[model samples]
Target: MHTVVIGGGVVGLSCALALAERGGDVTVCEAGTLGGGSTGRAAGGIRAQFSTPVNVDLSLASVPVWESFEERFGVDVDYRKNGYLFLAREEETAAAFEANVEMQTARGVDSRTLSPAEAREHCPQLRAEAFVAATYCPDDGVADPHSAVQGYSRAVEERGVDVRTRTPVTGLSPPESADGPWRVETPGETLSADYVVNAAGAWARRVGRLAGVELPIAPRRRQATVVEPETAMAESVPLTVDLDRGVYFRPEREGTALVGGHFADADPDVDPDDFSESPDLAWTAEAVERAADAAAYFGPETRVRNGWAGLYAVTPDHHAVVDEARPGFVVAAGFSGHGFQHAPATGECVAELCLDGAASHVDVSALSLERFESDEPGTVEQNVA
Candidate 1:
């Protein structure tokens, strides 16, 4: 239990590979470098099409560890299952996608319900009069957030766990036995650590005020757009989405295409080196007029050749705090931007909340920090960014 995991992205290298595979001598400190923040500008949309139920049980237990990330992390995080549609532009978002496809098929999640002529059997450049309903799923996909954090930072530093790149924690606090361990601070250097896991994406509330704890977290600046498809399309093609706006797109490799978070947010200012990615060209011209009749790259000469800007550590309800703010301080950041597909169930729930304090995987006791002081909904994840 000599933990220290701070932030190496992909949910702090999947929480230092589940606290060094439960042996716990992990280290991982990364203040910069290594798929930097928001897992290196993620648009890596892997999905369970959640609306809740602990985010569809953290994408159904993180889809068999992202389908065994290249046979257990050798590499190749190109895990593209090619499926995830979601469009619905009317009748109340198609009756909330018919109650979220009957609650993602009662939680088994292979979801369905298309019509817009079965979403052209999975996007034949959809535009079926611009979505009246579409839900698909097939298995939900996309990957390669820096090859899944370089395949979980080279298999969690070979289970010894000292990833440390540039080491900039700057402060953490809580020592002298609140349960011991955690003094941290860094620039020159300092350390203590019995446990201290705040996977600081979007600076987890200024690293929780260096440990006095304010952590309401806030970052929210998303932008993505990678298209190059003049027309060849299907590199498998899935992740379509139009969900009344917050745009989306997929397929990218050669006949590229990788749209953006259509819109509903983006304020920016929390500059961790600010990659303001400026392309809200009036929200991309109102997402090309609400994704022009469904969208085949919403014509009018579809452009946008480049884009980048990511950061969504929002909190105040978009859940993810992960408790124990005292007792050696823990608090897996604000994953309001869906921390890289919930990095394998937040690395087995921050290694069972740092070994046996709790974490039945998804209970996360509602992800604590006392639910922002009794508002009652810590880790409040209501499908964000």
Candidate 2:
């Protein structure tokens, strides 16, 4: 089967690679350079600590792929399994963490709840008195987002899949009949494919409109800042999150760390084409302050090195819309902020839907666009970062 994938982010590249591996003729068209979208700007976090079973299953399926990425793709993605620590400061949030741990543990994730003292033991930088409880998963970690994107791009090209950068898909024509192929239009030429996968990150809703389908994906701006702390941070320190404050920090290069979080009532619905790419000074100051409360090493003396803003294709439920939205068209977008970590499994599922008419690896039927048409849309995923 001939398949055309829209968007050139990590998810789109992975889908193309998986399709090529399945012996399907594939072509990937990106409007800009590879990984130029939200994928390149991602924080590179990979974790299985989730409140929902479907998300946990998706992460579980993707973790092994990330672990063996360098060996399989011949590119070192810098996969670091240091871990992810989530701190809860209030009783209600602490109870939620307990429930999340129970849900994650049932899904075979080795996540355990810890006391404030125990959490501080994992990272001496953490302020022990700031939180009531925490959750830690030793296997959850981070990787190089750029390396992963380039790795998958090369792998797909090696498999004879045509990857066209700077080739923007202007329009899409769904099949005229049951047996007709979908017509994909570009500025230079027109192409036909048996199937089309819409993996357009922040522009997924627009891409869906081209096919006469309406998707709930909206672009929300998120920013991250790098701080050079006055004190050095231990390399073993995991990515720590203050769930109550909506702030997080993780060790970056030596003596530096990356910190970011959303402020209460600060979430902005941004135009994917026209939003600030640079971080705001006020938001950066707030994020750094929150990070300092979570980790003592991120003191007030910490200097901001740099920062950038990226868009997250947020859905109403804050989960991914990963299903066949239209006949001959498959969607794997609107992951809120979890797209990078879950791209591997989502790609496999998209390929499975295109080739086998069903997804066996990870069942994503719950993420269908049809769910929104009902009175109850879908479950809101609580572990978004």
Candidate 3:
């Protein structure tokens, strides 16, 4: 079976690897260089601290892959198992943390709710007085996003998968009948494949439209800033998230940390083609202020080293849509901001769906696009940073 995956980001590369492993002829098409899209700009957090079961399951399934990434892909991803700390300031949010921990623990996540003092013990830089409660998962950690993408790209190509960079998929022709092959048109050539996977990251909606499928995915701009702290932060400090403030920071190097989060007032929908690639100075200033409030080490004297912007392929419920949009068109997009972390398991699931007609690794049927058509869209993940 020949499979053509559109988008050479992490997810696309991962799917290609899985399909190639299954003895299918696979090709990955990228409009730009590998990981040059959102994957390169991601903070690279891998955590099972989500409030939703599906998100937690995805993280859990991907953990083993991330832990043994170097062994599996022959590349060091810089996968760190320091931990993930989610702090809640408001009483209501604190209560949610307690409830979320319960759900996470029930699913074998090894997450626990923490008192303010306990949370401070993990990261002494935190303002203990500001937060009411927190959740800590020792299994959660961060990795190098660029390394992971490159690793997957290399592994897939080694397995006889054709990886074409700077190749934009212009259009798609779905089969007249369910069994017919799909036509994938590109600038230089057109290819016919038994299956097509849309893992186009920020441009997934446009890709879906080419297949005559109206995807709910939209591109939302997210900004991140790196700063050198006035006081060197502890290397043991976990990737900390101030849930109440919508701010998160993780150690980038010895004294530098990467910080950013969602700003409610920022443009929810951004034109992926024309949006600013450079970070906004004002927004970076605000993010630095918020980081300082969460961690005392990040004081007023902290120097903003640099900043950048990336797009999140967000769905209506801020969750991923990993299912077959049509007979031969499968979607592995609309992951909001979780695509990087979830790519491993999503790739397995996408391959299973295409090759075996079912996702047996982890039941991701809940992420189907048809879920949006229901009266209730199910639970929305609260732990989004």
Candidate 4:
């Protein structure tokens, strides 16, 4: 069957690859260059320490691909298994952390709750006195987002998928009947597809509307900065998160760390086409200050090297909407910030949805858009940084 996948980011390319591998004709339509959107700006964090089982399952299914990316895709994504440490300052938050650890562990994740002192073992500079509890998973780490994108792009091309860069889908028309074809219009040409996958990250809502579906996906601006700390951070240092303050810092190099978070009380949505790509100077300064508060690595002498801003296609509950919105139309967007890491698993699930009419690999039923319309939604993932 002919499938036109929208958004040529990592997730889009992945879905195309999976579909192509399953003996389907696939074409990828990207508004910009591959990975130039949120994928290129992502921090490349891959972790299984999630608060929900579905998110954890997604991570588990995707991490193995990342772990063996070089062997499978013939590209070195610089996957580092340094680890991820989450810190909770408030007692209530600490209790939540402990509960998350239990859930994660029950789901086969090698995660465990840690005392403040025990957590300090992973990052010696951590202010143990400030945090009441922590969680760590040695298997969680970071990778190169661009490299993964390149790998997926190359793999999809090898599978005979048409990848069109700088080609935006101008319009979309659903199939007239159950057996009809969907029309996908681009600036260059109009393509016919038996199925259409909406993997358009920040602009998913716009794409959904073209098919007469109202997707409640909002684009929220998130920024990150790399700083040369006063004291050199250990290369083995885990990606530490000050959960209460929404600050997260992971070692970038021997003496440098990448710091980022949402510190503002109000997170207003931004236009994906017009937002600034560079990080704000004031926000960078505040990120460093917050990082210092979490740990002593960032001192007064810490210098901001560089940073960039990206958009997170956020949903109301911070979980991705991976479901078939209608027959022959699949929506796999609103990853909030986990798109890069979860791309592999989501791709497989999308392929299943298109080919088998359901996802057999993972239970993504709770990720459907209709859940938001009901009174009860899925569990909210609280580990978002």
Please tell me which predicted candidate would have the highest TM-score against the true structure. Answer: 4
Segments of candidate 1 deviating more than 4 angstroms: 1-3, 8-30, 33-36, 44-47, 50-55, 59-103, 108-111, 115-187, 196-295, 298-300, 309-338, 341-348, 355-358, 361-385
The candidate, 1 or 3, that scores higher on TM-score is 3
Model 4 residue runs over 4 Å out of place are none
Model 1 residue 283 distance off true place after TM-score fit, in angstroms: 23
TM-score of each: 0.35, 0.98, 0.98, 0.99
Q: Clash number for model 3?
A: 0
Q: Count of backbone clashes for each model?
A: 7, 0, 0, 0
Worst 10 residues of 1 by lDDT: 376-385
**198-297 in candidate 2: lDDT tens per residue?**
9999999999999999998999999999989867777788888898898988889887888877876446678898999999999998998888877888
Note the residue pairs that clash in candidate 1: 130-294, 246-262, 247-262, 319-379, 319-380, 319-381, 320-379
The TM-score, computed over Cα atoms with residue i paired to residue i, of candidate 2 is 0.98
Q: List the global CA lDDT of all models.
A: 0.76, 0.91, 0.90, 0.92
**40-139, model 4: which lDDT tens digit per residue?**
9999999998888889999999988998999999999999999999999999998888888888888999999899999999999999999899999999
What is the descending lDDT order?
4, 2, 3, 1
lDDT by residue for model 3 (279-310), tens: 99888988889888988988878999998999
| Whole-structure CA lDDT of model 1 | 0.76
Best by lDDT: 4
